[model samples]
Target: MISRSDWLRDWQLVTRTALLILALTGTVAYAGSQVPIGKPPGESEPVPATMRGRFAGFVATLQFDNEAWTDAFVLAPDRRWFAEYARDATNIRVKDLRSGVTLRRLRTGGRKISGLAVSSDSRIVRAVDEDGKPLAWTVATGKSVSSEAEAEGINRIDHLTIHRWDNDISEPPGPTANPGQLISRFLASHGLSEQLPDLQTIEQVTTSVDGRYVAITEGYLGHLTIRDLSNSSAPVTIEWPEDWCGHYLASFAFDGHYVVLGTHGDEGDHAFTDAAAFEIKNGKAKALWHAECSVDRDAPEQISRDARFYAIGAAPNGPVVVWDLRAARRAAHFEGVYVAPIISADGSTFAVTKAASKGRRMLVLRHGKRRRLDANIEADPTGPIEDGVYALSSNGRYFAARIASATPGGKNAVGVWDTDSARQIRTIEPGGDAANSWKIAELSNTGDIILLADKSVFKAGRWIDVTEADESLLRGRSDSQLTPDNKHALIKQDLFLASFTLREIATGKTIWSLQGTPDLGFVMSFPDGRVRISPGAEKYLKLVRGFAVKPFDANAKRQFLRH
Candidate 1:
């Protein structure tokens, strides 16, 4: 089975090539305009003073770049500490989330960080290096909790590998070839699955919540090397039963007290197998329970935040089943193929999109009770992303659904529902020539909705339509710029800590741009159109052009250390 790392490598290659083309052509991928503050839809007058003040506060305090290349900002469960990795991946910083002050910065022994895991109490942190070695450090003391021998054992794997699909089709090479072998021969004659290596030394490591146990799975292998972080014992290697002929597709449960491995075999047979769960106690694992199930190869099991419950899309025309991992049994089951089953971080609620006969529906489960948020809405065959059907709020407090019309041929609308009450909080229906057929672009942590069609932000019963400011009238440009006509020039400064200015060619109108961090900065267009400053410091400024700048923030304390 193909691993996520292989897919990510392929995606990075494609993304790099696409960014090169965009940089050469001097094109802005998306507009980065701030969400506007305005009245709710259909209201002529502005919103109430208190609500307006809330909107202003929302835009100022919370500004996170969603399109950054690195997943640096990770908040601990307690929300006390936020660990941020450098853009170059050389170091990491643990910052106080409440005050936004830097606490400590530590280097990663020259190996780039591939994954990070923090404990629930926000006192311990576990960072996995690119070489699959795990480092456990105390957040309060900045001291290593792991010993040198344990770190060496974690990185002792001599080689890594990934199983190639092409190798499966190769003939057994003998007097007689079976039907499968004949098909493989035919495919090989056509020059398929050639040149790609079957395995390599690149693996992904995942850790438990308390930073005690870690499971290292190679990209192409079915065997798993489990490490006990809190103890000095040797790593334990586990594989599926020989009869299953299973390969490691992904991790089923890699958090909390138990670690479950997911395996996938041939289609229509045992598509997915949880098979067993290992309970970790005192930094040692013992076989606890064996809960086995059949699921499609594409649909892996989804676990709740606290690792108490898990949802699986059953295979071969099966129902979606919710499993109670602690009980080692099935908890609930629902009919039909539901899409995007997301559970709350606390495991208090769960959300999934269902396909109803009349139309598409969103079903939320709270305390063993199921309620359909949108029963009559039309089922959107396509989702926001390639594989995702609908977007669910991270906390499972809300979900976004595209509302199908009650009439057979009526226009569709976008609706946001509150999961607690199973009630539709807001519905955005565009009339006449308005921007209709909208998809959810973002769902903020504060339970606000942002539509992709016009960048309309819906927060606190208000509509902040930014189509005029964000969506330019230019034929090719997709950046936020106020240009009355193509003749007038739009210039921006404050790209760096230094100062810069620009003037229009025909009218000679000077435009001064203010200071913005690399995350919020914009590009500037020169008069002759030959020179242009680019946005996306990591994409254009850092990756392709090889630029590096570290701006100083006086409010944040700084400390650096070598490990």
Candidate 2:
């Protein structure tokens, strides 16, 4: 992903690239205006307001006359979108960009203002809060399905919530922002399975890697259950520990046998805190460990002292600590790094940084000493350099981080660095001392492209073509699904699935864009919210990228982590 300054970037280049692919082969646009390495998207302004600039293309946002309640929004692949909760102390309204409408008088149940997530189709919406609770409501009367709405070829409103909320139960604090149209929130609130009545509060919920099974903790009935999502209803349930904390349900072992739970440790993580570990097998949960932590389980003070969220790598390399649930011992610890970024298809690697002073390192862990990689990077990460690095491609080739310094009175873009040479490759968009650091949300498998986002949904960041290489995609839509080979792309859009069409390699014209009426496609949307369409990846590059962080929280209710 091309990192941007704290300024919210928009979705353009990727959309352009996708358009290029969907069109046909050999359709390339020549560049006229050159956005330099240090050029800000615009000149200085007193505050963070949306404006039209030469480089800031197609900016869109929903703002009230006198309100500071701004939350980021996401546009679905097919154009539907969802807004993060816009808050003041009292009134909470979500806006739709398409019709310039807001969900006034929303019939929501919870007041805690925890989180809100929208599905790609926008048919179903899930709401939750900090305390890991659930809220049900219909925000839109014009184009939304209620929890009880039912229809043919359309998802049952009942099944939609269970499935939608289940995935969101453990929002991982950030958007996935992959080229693929997958979104997850940490506090997804899934409905319970059968065979056990009188269910109360569910502590945690986690879906298996394959999207086959979902493990959830029900605090009310004192049981742990694994639901075979293959069938939404009648899911199987496992037993549980009497005093388990749902907040601690993050993840399990690779083999899926030993479940990792916090323990009553000698250190501060135990003694008084609610953090604990558990081992689940044969449909039961056994308490194994316990530790104290802040609400997010992140250790703000010190690691040996009271660290909550786990980090394995230092700044550029690793502080990563592999956990062995069965042995209940620390596996391997790479000191300098905090977390290993997703690697490329061939097992080439990248890392994330938690530091902010000097430039962080990006190196290849080839058998031993760091072998810094050198590759072409399109744009840098957006934001403060001190916040450290975010999304990196699979190969230890390039990195994205907040732009450290800025030319006065200008916006800022992320800084792309040559991990091998420890030199600045380029500075993307720049502006504002008020810029929120960009989040490294999108990454491609072939290490060809990436996406970056900030606090604003008005603009998104996409780095297309290349500053130094022939990385242009030949064909494919941003919404197109990747063929198994990753070399080709299939552009199919719509809700009912059949309404979607497939486009071939680049020529900048649609090979096929399926026609669908609202009924044939059956798309769910931002429940009468606003959304915009943008370009995605290109097909010309002939590459594929897939990445995921290791599951560290067995007690993971990822819902709490969603942004």
Candidate 3:
């Protein structure tokens, strides 16, 4: 017999208390969960499904057994099919997005597959195994291919063509003629004028050392186009040979005078089979030479400053090889699994470590002679020697290696060595609270300075805490970016909600700050008025139509400078 209003008030209070308990206990049903602000519970904490902003609700719930499952799904460009990991994580299921029907199941041969991608035609699915081996499957036939050639062959397009801008013109255009106009005319002639509104998918981009030429590879067809920054009116288009199936890498050498193309195919243990050099002559690329070589996909290929030599190899164990590009021959070969093989600009010195051996011993090859230098640094058997752990100067005069702590719970350090005398020259230790997070160690080209992430900078033979110098804006921040000119920085702090601050590096003054919007996950819109959201974003899309946030515009940088 209680009053109706009094009864409703009591019910509301009980409901609110129940929700608070559910949020704190993480019993929420969708992929989203409420997390506490401040430091994460552990170092390897997974990203929360909640979006960033005050009063912003969860945007999506990511359904996965673990964090690794976040990248195991991909949608085709045609919007017809999508590929995702099966429940077992050992197989991939290609399903039609429109009907929500499973089309085919692809076996992974017991290897866990990740990085799933669909071809442009929606006929093939490609992924990489846990061991870094490439795998592919045909959607319709449910067939699998082990060889690189067969994998690429099934995805090749027959009508792929390259269009050149300067092909019909006998002379360069006058200054009054706009380069944009010329490009527009070329596109119209090729029946691509109406398609200009669509975004062009570029797989890779490389610029010449001199910064004059830029090479762009089309994502789907492997066609290449070279554009001169000085003369944008005349772009050279190079088509891959019909026999070739895929383009692995492209690079510039000899100050933009030579263009090197790496193609993958042929039966071998490696994916990169052919490395070809092309000379730029009269606004055209003429093939100079081609060599049968294998380059590791994960290793970063090194090219000498003068473009006279190239070194390529990878970890665990390696038969590291150095190639003399000018002479078209192999210069030197070292048979051992080494860590971080590097070549000097003058092609006179090379440094690498015998990772499998004990002690901090470095192998130095100078002028065809090999010597071992004892860095006098203790090795941490538990720590893995990753890419950024070691750095060498461009001249090879100085080499830097991360010194692992001698005892457990001890701090790490950096040791610099003079390659000529094979002696440790200096040891730089992390300062303040940054010692625990010290990961990336870098050496300047001249070997006069060292940078330990964004935390510390070693200059003039002294360590300076960069975070303290920058007014501690970057303190405790995991992700931050510095402008190329070193004048400004963007610091991002993610707690319960993400926030960003643009600060002046020298003055340590905050220029602007903004709250980040929640990540709605990956969404693909189709022409047929259908939309597809990733599994992680499906539930979140129903809660919010859009976000109100200020996005950074590159064109408005000048406006920011005025502030």
Candidate 4:
């Protein structure tokens, strides 16, 4: 995932690049037509006082074509003047709301303005530059007006929040208690809130490869629980030391007998203090090994299916620590933010991007040796940099990366490569026009098939529209998601109701159906028709053949919210 800072920087870079391209091409008409300048035509009529507020609200939603970067807006206290600042441009556009005309453009002399605020009297506009320095301008004359004290008094809107117009609809009132309290009450009713007074909520839910085991964690406190879905055995809960900070990373080993947990220090600390492997046996968890490591909070971490290796690290410029769980030591440490670090099921092979390199310089590590393969993934300046664009097969014998079009107006494609020989295997390009083009969603575990966002499957060197093939099962559905393996799909029957159905993608056979309310709670279903839901949804959760639901104990409910 791209950080907010990175996303904003990329947006600015793209805007600047577009401007430079237009300048070099000598396209004055193109630039003039795209950018809004001066007063728009027919602004003589004065907006009615009654409608001025509504007009200002409408103007707040307007954006120039090149204003694609981060921006801010401030309406004067009287709503007579509006100030706008675009990160890509070095000027603030002040408009007269009453007359519906551009009043003045305040230049910042190339400094990037990040925030904007208008004075109560509508004569002065204060701004904070990217460096947090104060700047002010006169609205009437477009002259710089420096007043440190005045700038300090202004409350700036640092970043503008842009929401879809349809999202303006008011939503129903939320629960009186916080989400954490509600989750706690729900868990207590299910008899799963033992020794968990600090349990805020279910942080994450991870399932084993075969969907037989699940590992859940309490986000606030360092509590971990592993449950076996194959049998009716009591879950094994592991609680960390009271002084040890929370655990944000947890994953089940591919074999389902072991799990890995990564811990970090208190708030503001990004380093991982310790990562431990636990062996589960006889309904109990025993610590196998613990290793100290530093990993970024947003970094990627993965545990091999064989339970022999675990990889964790930060990105951009952080260490990628690959630990040998069997030996309880660090096997290899690579520096640089890797696009994706994937370990083979057997721990004999690994695929990752080259350390500190531009473009997708891929490297495959086999038997403690590295071989470089230039994937030549093109950069898409018009879009934010996406993570997980590259995927490695479980066997680590195949690699796939989403590739941009070689030329402008060309179709994007996905390239697959042979890891062993470091050779290009094939490039699969989905068919569609530019507007409705198919995007690469996921690469199959084996790297032989690719799933597109439009529910299309690419296999055997051809694209198959699964939506068309399974029309009977998907017709009139609100939303649907095909399993990673493309064998089954989870479908929602309505947009405003909680009605779901699990169906086989190939045969259109309904495996099970469920009906509930919007607040029915968290639900997770596996490709094999196994469904697991939180206690809040248990009352309405119906499964044809899956784990038995625990009866809710109303007597165990606690008043988590204080009066």
Instruction: Pick the lDDT winner.
Output: 4
TM-score winner between 1 and 3, please give it. 3
* Per-prediction CA RMSD (Å): 21.6, 22.6, 25.9, 27.4
Question: Per-residue lDDT for 156-177 in model 4, tens only?
Answer: 4431111111122244454333
TM-score of every model versus the real structure: 0.30, 0.27, 0.32, 0.32
> Model 4: C-alpha RMSD to truth?
27.4
Ordered by TM-score, highest first, the candidates read 3, 4, 1, 2
The better candidate by TM-score, 1 or 4, is 4
Candidate number that wins on TM-score, 2 or 3 = 3
Q: Tell me the tens digit of each residue's lDDT in model 3 across 441-509.
A: 335555654444555644455566554444232222224434333345545433322334444543434
Better lDDT candidate (3, 4): 4
Predicted candidate 1, C-alpha RMSD: 21.6
lDDT of 1: 0.43
Model 3 worst lDDT window (10 residues) = 61-70
Candidate models: Cα lDDT each: 0.43, 0.32, 0.46, 0.48
Model 1 TM-score?
0.30
**Candidate 1 structure quality by residue, lDDT tens digits, 376-470:** 55454333112222456656777766666545666766667787788888765544333354555445444666454444443333455655534
